[model samples]
Target: MAARSSHLSLALLLVMAVGCAAQDYDFFYLVLQWPGSYCDTRQSCCYPKSGKPAADFGIHGLWPNRDDGSYPQNCNPDAAFDPSKVSDLLSELRANWPTLACPTNDGLRFWGHEWEKHGTCAANAFNEHGYFQTALRLRDQLNVLDALTSGGVSPDGGYYTLGQIKDAIKRGTGFEPYVECNRDESGNTQLYQLYFCVDTAGDRFIDCPVLPRGRACSNRIEFPAF
Candidate 1:
């Protein structure tokens, strides 16, 4: 009986260890969202406690996904998000990944959700600070507004085809991107999120292996203003 109990304990420990370790994923989808369209919906939006984010695009998340468009979520629940780990990045995160969810917050909950839901899965490549660090670095280097405006695609409530938008971003980033859209209060289509694939290292951009489904937009979509 004593020997059997010891073996059971050892097996349990090994299972726990396996479950707590970092995850492996094929690639990452570095998603960026436009704040203007987010709030323009019927659900509306509240600014972050830190204040209204910049008119520029903000991060949605650096989601870990497989080539088949499936993804891992809430991986390694033991590795919860710790604000202290990213204390140095709070200011920058508030500006780049601020929450527009209702009942305003200091962005911790938003960051926490992202960290737990998606960031944890990238543990093999990033710690808490490194996760946000990579995202902020990617966002800072690629200004979606500049990418669009530079190609005569201003967000002055103008309507543009999906092709036009994709071409502009491709020109700016030197790679193709997948544009997602949402409906405004007036029932018109507007830009929502932009998806770009990145290497597991979270460094440079790469062509997406599989474009996410259900991101269809009409022949003409609005690039609403902030």
Candidate 2:
């Protein structure tokens, strides 16, 4: 009986060790892109064959990030992106995650890149379908445009303080989001993206340990008109 008990304890230890060694990210960065800002810099933005996306911020990507400002990508080579797996989500994806690359691009290519680079890394927590479904659900839950507009921030070429933007998002979502911006042709800082950190479960929001590299924004930023 003592030998059997020892074997069971060893087995449990092995299981725990394997769990700890798993390829898991620290958190998820739910990134949203401002179409207006992107088009202003690029001079032109292409839409998928479906149609132009709504003026609202679109999903840039759902990335897996680490605590040290670095992130994992293309984690599983074998888990290649399969478009058929997410066929049911194409409508929502086209509406929310449209490709804005220049010279026109397909949603499938954008999804493939996202899946190969980021989705594969998050495979332990979510399969391809769950990874995308969670993003769409979260986008519906967190309304960045409404949050800013309600807080007196509009896209009519108005300059806002970074503190104001963060405060507004916190008031709307009960959590502060990491704000990112880029400079316009006139050298004014404009809101480019917003990233909210999510736990590995891809369910709840969490405070980011460190922001993404080179995502610093000035104290006052502009929200360009679409």
Candidate 3:
């Protein structure tokens, strides 16, 4: 009887260790891919914006509105453009929860800018990596929300707090947390950060792209649920 009890204790210990190992693996993977997981850039100054002549905008960057300004000269066939990919972000929210009623407004609201609209919105508003990053954060957070509703573990590996979803963007996981955004040093819009969260009291939206500097719009994101 004594030996059986000892064996049972050892088995429980082994099971706990395995669980810990799995959690560590998931947490670290998120840390390493933190940046690439959630950000993208656009070609704003690369093409001259209207009113500003092509020469004034220069050739190094894109400026949104020039007829003959700098663009991907000799566009490659392999990298065709498409916008349907990101349009669903809005649609999904509408479909999943009908009463939310967040409008597909006239112009895009890119935070900080306070209601900037795209004259002609493109197919890929969320950018390349934004797809995976938003998906992962949303999925993980949804899991947490579900567990909370059902009364289970938070799935932060028991490390992050309930509010850490927003905090994690700047400080990351497995480290002493600290606030990192809220400035305009690198052309990153601080408002875009809101969209990246997995869950929020408000409607969810993905972080839009800021050309030249990726993740600059991290603060501008909306946490829409669909």
Residue 115 C-alpha lDDT in model 2? 88
lDDT assessment of candidate 2: 0.86
**Poorest lDDT segment (10 consecutive residues) of candidate 2:** 16-25
Query: lDDT of each model, Cα atoms only?
Result: 0.88, 0.86, 0.26
For residues 23-132, write the lDDT of model 3, one tens digit per residue.
32111111111111122223221111112121110011111211232212212233333334445454332222112112323222221011111111111223322432
Worst 10 residues of 3 by lDDT: 54-63
Q: The CA-based lDDT of model 3 is what? A: 0.26
Compared with the true structure, what per-residue lDDT tens digits does model 2 show for residues 32-70?
998888877746577778877888888988999888778
Q: Can you give the TM-score per candidate against the true fold?
A: 0.89, 0.89, 0.20
Q: TM-score for model 2?
A: 0.89
lDDT of 1 by residue, 1-226 (tens): 9999999999999988766453357789989999999999999999988888988899999998887779898987899889999999988999899899999889888899999999888888878899999999988877777889988888889999998898898888787778899999999999999988898789888888898874689879999999
Assess candidate 1 and give its TM-score to the true structure. Answer: 0.89
